[model samples]
Target: MESLVLTIPQVRKIVLEAAGLARKAQFGIGIEAVYRIIDHLGFVQLDTNYVVERAHHHVMAARIPDYQTEWLAELCEDGSIFEYFTSASGFLPMHDFRFTLPIKKAFKAQRKPLTQAETNLMKQILDRAEREESLTVGDFENDRVEASSGWWDWRLRAS
Candidate 1:
């Protein structure tokens, strides 16, 4: 039988290194570096608040010397990474997308079943997204009379 003990400093160093914060440029530079970092870390929380800069950008820039904010968008657009809720909202490597299925399932199970009208609205939104190639919440106006239902509710402007 054998056991190993770690000093406090040693444990702190280990945790920080695993989090990619033991030193600077841990993931190097450029968009490829961004992918590598996300793949290594598994998830990076995304924050839209920009008092100075977005939290996700700040996180990537701290470890990547040439990190650019646009790189995240580019990676997401190209399907190399994706943003979704997992404990918290964040970005995850595209390859890890399937691992989030359980979280999605749990969320759906806790919610009431969608009404037929809500289901129909969802189909309309999906169709619009397919036709438009891309869609954002702002793409639709707040014209729904049923009251904002949930996160997936898509508000459309009156035509």
Candidate 2:
């Protein structure tokens, strides 16, 4: 039997397609499955399996093709791939720091904590309503009670 060697790019394409299909159907594609395929294709290292798995998680988030292809391309162009890799897996260069941070402080400030008075008022109102009606108010804080208070006015509007 002839041995077949699969490159990182080829495996990445397959993983992306599979993930896309899974996403469309509202299902999850296991990371283990993707790594197993990579291992089967002899692209992963036997000693760096754990590192490869971690890198796979990072790579999947990158939405990039296989690590090897990217690494090779970087090497061909830049001559050195300075990154970490598991003994059983390929390398992910440290330079490709793709994680994005919230740049706009103003935008993040919009999600700031509510004022003490506002929070107390909301809690008091909700507590009174729950006590009077013996009703459960699930996650009122998370669901934004003030914003959703107008929902009750729908009945009055209809009448």
Candidate 3:
């Protein structure tokens, strides 16, 4: 067997190319490009943390020119992609959906059993959903009378 050797810079170049970062617009910006990029990368970790922009959007914009943030939601809406936790929270190609089952099974096996109150709450929510043709967060009564302090807050800002 022969072992290949490469210098530090060469290895770095290879890694960058594989990650679609060796050049700008490595994949043309569009929905198709989004799918191709996700497929090639295997997974693009999702992050909700925002300083300037969300981590996931920053990633796409870096590698893809004219990247639109809405494309992610559109892909999800059309079932072209899905969000799941695989080592990390991220998006995966829909064709790879079956691969997630084992991870889900493992999580289910490892999780603590739900308490009676939690179980009842789950049943109640499920029943309500089944009976109602339409439901909204406003339908629920809670002590959240105050504005949310985190991401769930939907207060729009002036443009």
Candidate 4:
């Protein structure tokens, strides 16, 4: 197969234009604009840091300048969109969930033999999730904690 090559400037322009088009930043906003944008871009990657604003929200805002963040939340609640890992935190079409299942299965398969205490910890998490409609790591308070500022530190990350 033959490959086409371009100068640095040409490559940069193409990349910039592609990035803008992918985000729909060059266009105007609409009520359901996020769906089109995410669909076009394939996935709206989720980010934890908010030194300015959450990544997903910022990405949507650039495209739908007049749209509200709550709209994205509603989309998630209505099951129109879903979150999955694609090299990063990502919001993708609900139908794409099937693609991520293999990753989950592989992760489960690779775990080391669990110590009895770790097994109990896993059991507690599952039991609570079964009882509660929703759950968080903060609910897992116990001696089995890392005793440091991480997920168990009770910080709510956007995903």
| Top candidate (lDDT) | 1
Candidate ranking under lDDT, highest first, comes to 1, 3, 4, 2
Per-prediction TM-score to the true structure, in the order listed:
0.67, 0.20, 0.71, 0.62
- Model 4 steric clash pairs: none
Tens-place lDDT digits, model 1, residues 77-97: 999999998567999899999
Model 2 lDDT tens row, 71-116:
3444425633323333333533333323212423445778878899
RMSD of 4: 5.2
Cα lDDT, model 1, residue 139: 78
Instruction: Name the lDDT of candidate 1.
Output: 0.87
**What lDDT does candidate 1 reach at residue 53?**
94
Indicate whether candidate 3 or candidate 4 has the larger lDDT.
3
Better of 2 and 3 by TM-score: 3
* lDDT scores of the candidates, listed in order: 0.87, 0.43, 0.86, 0.74
Displacement of residue 33 (Cα, Å) in model 1 is 1.1
- How many backbone collisions does model 4 have? 0
User: How displaced is residue 97 in candidate 3, in Å?
Assistant: 0.8
lDDT of 2: 0.43
Which ranges of candidate 2 are over 4 A from the true structure?
Answer: 1-100, 110-113, 119-159
Local accuracy of candidate 4 as per-residue lDDT tens digits, 19-116: 55544445457646777667667798998768988888888786677768887778788887888875788888777778889989898899788999
